[model samples]
Target: MTDIPNIPFVDLASQQNRIRADIDKAMARVLDHGRYVMGPEVAELEAELSKFCGAKHSIGCSSGTDALAMVLMAKNLRAGQVIFCPSFTFVATAEVVAWLGAKVCFVDVEPDTFNMDPKALKAAIETAKANGEDLAGIIVVDLFGLPADYVSILKIAEENDLWLMSDAAQSFGARYHNAPIGTNGIATATSFFPAKPLGAYGDGGAMFTDDDELAEDLRSILFHGKGTSQYDNVRIGMTGRLDTMQAAVLLEKLKIFDSEIVERQKVADRYTSGLSDIVTCPHVPEGCQSVWAQYTTRLPQGLDRDALQAQLKDKGIPTAVYYAKPLHRQDAYKHNLIAGQTSDGVLPVTDALSLDVLSLPMHPYLSDDTQDYIIEHIRGAISDLS
Candidate 1:
């Protein structure tokens, strides 16, 4: 058999090559200024982010985790309080809640969208109240770049008197009901990790909000809870500020983020057209647009996902699983409460998805031929296995 050439899971090099000159200039400017910590570039990047997302304020932070932690800190999330989050997502969504000494109530996700199910959220809230738990808020994750069902989730939050925070780490450039992702909830947090849709050269993140007071609280929390001056310690905080050099790189990347989102959609469309017959392609609800951070699909039932990934690997194609185990099933969260749980546990959809989800090579620079190759191999492997 002829060996297939290796394909990059994410073609960051191509993106960097295109913007290397601008990135270099941006970095050089930061170097010349010598204000690496909370420098002028950080503010400039925050302003651009606000302009891009239509949010009234954007605060740059050290990472997506910090962005979320800062918001919870600003909200004064306390011990014994419960925050509901989907089980079928990265750990960071629930990790921040746990960090605040609060309980994380695991919620099931919609199988098709891989986002939080509003019904599950409502049931969770009711169960928590019945159990005499202090229900605080909800953190909805935009898994794999598609925004959660915000219309329904927002209504749930309002009726329950719980605040909503969007974990847009994977869906920063996405839209929900024609509104940007960052504008949906009380505050939205997004990462600039190199693998994300709008990734930077290194770790960085931002928080977006329309509430003036909440915005001020976030700024204070990220800066060690400073009051009138740096010496004045008002509230407890952490070192969550985004570095100036990372902000500089992100500023350049933001210039072409929209265009890159368009390109990413093209790649996703091609993948769906080629592989939809064999696998369950991602579903973007009407009036919503995904950034295609990871072109994930659900593999056929009764098929071994690990075996399929190994087959692809042999052909020089790489694959990844977003979450192999739901948060409810993980060791650290085993004791955490799950929504709608009776004697038997719930979160059936979340459990099922953790076993079958597969992420393909996804990025804006994926060429048609490369995508077609991936599509053909995936289809062929599934056929042979069947």
Candidate 2:
């Protein structure tokens, strides 16, 4: 019996190794400067990120959650104001809204892209208005590295006079209609958690926007809402500034982000082709590019998704469920949903996705051999159930 090599869900070490020298230099420079908080690297990274995403400004923050919170704080969202977002995403997307005392009306996601469905968003707005709720804005999450349908969502926001925020936490490097993800909405927020496609060494995030005034407000909100000087506090804020060390690391990573995105696409192409026949593979809509944050596949109906996960584990291949339960179904949020009604009656698509989806190992550095092993074991697991 031979021991199979354990495959990581995200191979950050491989990426780090590829650019070890550059990363070392970036860090060493930060250490020498000894200005760890809001140092030069922070502004340098922000400028570089703005250029990369074609935004006028990018404000660095402590985390993706804070980035969202800062934008909402800048807007001064209050209780009774409703923000529409898909229930299929990480809680951070809606958690910020809740923290700001704003109502979060959960919407259903598209069946294929796992992104916020624009039609569902429109329906949610109507449902909220019918309940006499004060509609405030929309936060479209780019779930699993694919951008949401921004074309229709942007139009809907304009029609209703609502702020549209792009939660590009997983889709930062992706594109929609050939435009970078960050520039499509009024504001875009992204995470730099270690597992993300363009992660830093630790927790970090950034907000991108073309609006000069909004950008200024975000910057102020990120730093205790200081007016003109650090001592001059103009409004309420939080400690949400990104660490200079993380920014230094990100600057090195950003240098190769484009090439890495291309590599991720190649890995996704292989997974889609190999696993499509056995299980439902991911679908990237036309004119959109995913960073392949997680190569999730849905198990066929009647197959126990958990059992298959266990089988893959025994084979030394790791698997995870992105969200075994959608946010609306989670205990904390169940009370938020009207008894017998959600925005679209039941959020059918989000409910179904929760039961069947499983995420396999994914990253820019996934090797062909490891993927072949993964596909073979997946087929074996399915066969055993049959």
Candidate 3:
């Protein structure tokens, strides 16, 4: 293999170089104001986020996990109620449900889009109902950067009298059916975890909602459940505020976020065009636009994924597995109920996906030459393994 520089999994440096001056100026203003917590920048960012996604309200928080938890807290999620979630996703999605003493029933996902399967969700709700368990809500994750089947999931939620929350942590900049992601579900939560499409310098997240009462509840819950002032606590809450400095950084990143999304789609198009015949490329349904948070591909059946990754590394190509194990298979969530679990007790699609998904280097700055090199090496590695 020819020698080449190691490619970045997500190039933050290049993005910084593009907006360094604006970032510096934004940070300087925050420093001069001396209101590191809930300062002017925080409000400015929240307003901009709401405008970007067409949400009536946007509440900035400390992290993605906190953003989800705060919503659960505001909704008063309690023990014994079950909330359905996809098993093939980050633990944070289910973790917040457990934190509130609620049961998390794991659901399967679509084999192609990798988002929660609506059929599986409906089956889970019926199964829980037959067992006399209380059904509360559903948290549908937009896996990778593509929005889930909200059109189907929302109908199911309405029929079952359950609310819906979208985990848009990875798909914040994406769109679904000509509408922005944050406007689909009852409330949407997104992350700014430095690796996301519209990332901040450090940990940050926000919640978007058109519900006025929910928005007010979230604002109160994020700051010790304050009624009017911080000293006057009315309900149980935590310190979940986003730092002003992180908000300032995010304000700058949000400026170029739309342009970055376009660049990411171009890179994804190149990958699909170059490698679709060799591997199963990601699928984006009509009227949906993925931000391409991670360009994940499914390896061919019987292909040795470990061998392919190792061989790619030998050629200075970096590769990663988004999830080598589904959440239901993890030790922490082994005992959770899996939707559509029969005598075999497995989610067929989620289990299969866990063993095959591989993420390549993805970022707006990924040059065509670098991407072509990565694609060529992937082809070579797969051919050798086959």
Q: Please, what is the whole-model Cα lDDT of each candidate in the order they appear?
A: 0.90, 0.88, 0.91
- Lowest summed lDDT across 10 adjacent residues in model 1 is found at 336-345
Backbone clash total for model 3 is 0
Supply the global lDDT for candidate 2: 0.88
RMSD of 1: 1.5
**Which candidate ranks first by lDDT, i.e. highest?**
3
lDDT of 3 by residue, 142-225 (tens): 999999999999999999999999999999999999888898777999999999999988899999999999999999999999
Instruction: State in Å the error of residue 271, model 2.
Output: 0.7
lDDT of 3: 0.91
Q: Which ten residues in a row have the lowest lDDT in candidate 2?
A: 336-345
Model 2: lDDT of residue 277: 93
Per-residue accuracy of model 1 over 141-245 as CA lDDT, tens digit each: 999999898889999999999999999999999988887889888999999999998888889999999999999989888888989866788899889999999
Q: Write model 2 residue lDDT over 106-223, tens digit each, in one string.
A: 8889888999888888887877778888888889999999988888999999999998998999989998899888887779999999999999999999999999999988888888
Which residue pairs overlap in candidate 2's backbone?
none
My TM-score estimates for the predictions, one after another, are 0.97, 0.97, 0.97
Location of the lowest summed lDDT over 10 successive residues in candidate 3? 335-344
